[model samples]
Target: MVSYITSTQTLSFARKPHPKEEVCGDDGAAWDDPDHTWLVISDGLGHGAGAAKATEAALSWITANYSNNLEATVRGCDKAIRHTRGVSLNIARINRSTKATDYVSVGANLGWKVQRSGIQRFAGDSGVVGSGVRNLKTTRVDLDGAGYLVLASDGLNTTSDVSALYHSTFDGDVSLAEACLERWTTGKDDSSIFVYRFT
Candidate 1:
């Protein structure tokens, strides 16, 4: 697990490998610039080292050539890891001042925004990152007030009610992530969860 704190937001990430595997297939990263904070999650196709390799390649490309443009960044990641097993990818760019976020996702990854009122789900375009992308589009949402942004790989049960989990066990960013992983992980594949809290 890793955590990042800023003046406006706090982010926490946690991941676990499949029970039979030594390496996790899902990976993620978060970084900040003067004007924006970036978050990314990548889940490779299968389990074990090959899947880990694909995720590592995608994250490395993003680290070396970080960009604020969500679509272009996803395309670049697709190109960078074309040789390895393809991955499911999601990227988010949040404005430091306005709290508006631009998010893009490809493949089966999941995302949601949880506020006091309700939970808003974010869906990704249908395609694999390294293989190809179709109907690529960026979704925008406002994170100005208190809320939580949750991103998870398919290893976590998508059918689970995250809003209920948030409301019941909401302590802080780190605890929310830990609870989600503890309660929802499928245990058959690599699992990852990212929770971002903004006020």
Candidate 2:
């Protein structure tokens, strides 16, 4: 029950298992640009060295090569982690001018908060990068004045109740993000979360 930071407009944070010896490999990033804002979370398989490599590789490609082409970005990430593989990734990018968000994602589950509203949600059936293949879909959402985002791995919980969780938390505490992560996650996998809790 950590009091993770939640603010108006721009904010981001995450929690992962201790790296190295522990199999806790949580990979994540965020960027708010005049043209766009982007955030990524990749959970590498296993723990320690291998997971780190997979995560680092995926993140490097996504941030460096994210452009107008969402499909291209997905392909690039797949290719980068062909050898070391993992499931669950949440990539969110928001366009400043249009107030639109293009989410190029694969695997597990993701969620959102509209400032004062509680956490809403989304998920992928099997979004994993491997053999460096590009198998991603882009989802576009119109943003209100301000909204928050949470990219969580299945490790925290299974993805069975994604849509249900969204409808339920309409005016709850910001800590609800942590609630979803802990309540649903399996715990067997390496669980982690990268959250951009905004106002």
Candidate 3:
């Protein structure tokens, strides 16, 4: 399969509670040095301001300290919210030089993929965030084989039927990603997604 080394990112957030409840939020950024870019999504435990603040804090911390060790960053975030426990996150670091990607999660949903010609998926942690769970995984891409990194919260209700969005085609992942999130994020919890485009 042909791979891509491009990196593109897009995200969507749908307000929940059908009106005021917003359950999800996402953010991402790449470095100019080609060292790596960061993608992070944090689902606050509850709804309203409390949830928003929790998720916001998580992303802020990630971007602020992404230059450090990823595992330490994950562990640090977990320790800070031991009591409030309003965070579920998936943080990925894509390195241009090594073609290595590292992911750190805490009670968040796992990841899914739309490889150039294949589909892969991972599940979520059973418990809530702030439970002192350190679930992390790292993968290396061919830098020219894979094109996108797709991740979403469980609210999408699409655990089993993701084929419609992740077909084997040359379609841009940002477009496909937004379409899927718009369809899946309709619950009380806000629906959020983060897509990374690869070169």
Candidate 4:
């Protein structure tokens, strides 16, 4: 089996139910299949209960149908959450055999491949998954050795400033993702980051 590891960091708006809020603004899921490893991050449309509901709805759909191809999984999520507030989501699948990657995004979430060479951004199309999806497009890239794909919800500050990550030694450590998530977090809204390493 191919070696794959994931690290995640999540924070709630104002620290959540400490103030009696029912849910955070975002949620996510991850798993490994025979041919690919999957990582998904979802941000609901707004803050508080509605946002949490939307994200959870989308996440449930993702969990139930992620075994499908990237495009179909996204469409399933879109259909599943149409009655809710909708969500912004990013899904990434790493091919266990070829070390290649297939990913799809909807709404404002950000994702990218971090390699020794440089960062390869996965720009998502406009429109929410459960709302006004005009089209769904999958971005494919080869995730060669020592490559990492990072997916972040919009709650983070700047998705482009991933330079610090490349500076770290490529020892296949989860600390890199932890450090990046800690350093980049704005602490404004519900924030989360998922790191997938192909080793």
Clashes of each: 0, 10, 11, 0
Q: Say which candidate scores most in TM-score.
A: 1
Please provide, for model 1 over 34-134, each residue's C-alpha lDDT reduced to its tens digit, 9 standing for 90 to 100. 98887788898998999999998888888778777778888888888899889998888889789899989898888889888888889889898888776
Worst 10 residues of 2 by lDDT: 1-10
Model 4: CA > 4 A from native: 1-22, 168-175
For 1-199, candidate 4 gives per-residue lDDT tens digits of: 0112333232111112112345676766776677766778888887788888888888777776666577778877788899999999888877778977888898888887777778888878888889867778988888776766788887777644775666745334545555665666666676667766565
lDDT comparing candidate 1 with the true structure: 0.83
Q: Highest lDDT, which number?
A: 1
Worst 10 residues of 4 by lDDT: 10-19
Task: Give all candidates' CA lDDT scores.
Answer: 0.83, 0.60, 0.56, 0.71
For each candidate, give its TM-score against the true structure.
0.91, 0.71, 0.72, 0.81
70: Cα error in model 4, Å: 2.0
Cα-lDDT of candidate 4: 0.71
User: Tens digit of lDDT per residue, candidate 3, span 68-95?
Assistant: 4776777676666665646767666667
Model 4 collision count: 0
Stretches of candidate 2 exceeding 4 Å from the true structure = 1-9, 18-23, 113-119, 125-127, 132-135, 158-186
Error of 3 at 180 (Å): 2.0
Q: Give the per-residue lDDT of model 2 (tens digit) for 66-172.
A: 77787777776677677776545677776766767777567654545444454455545465676544446677766665555666665665443544444565334
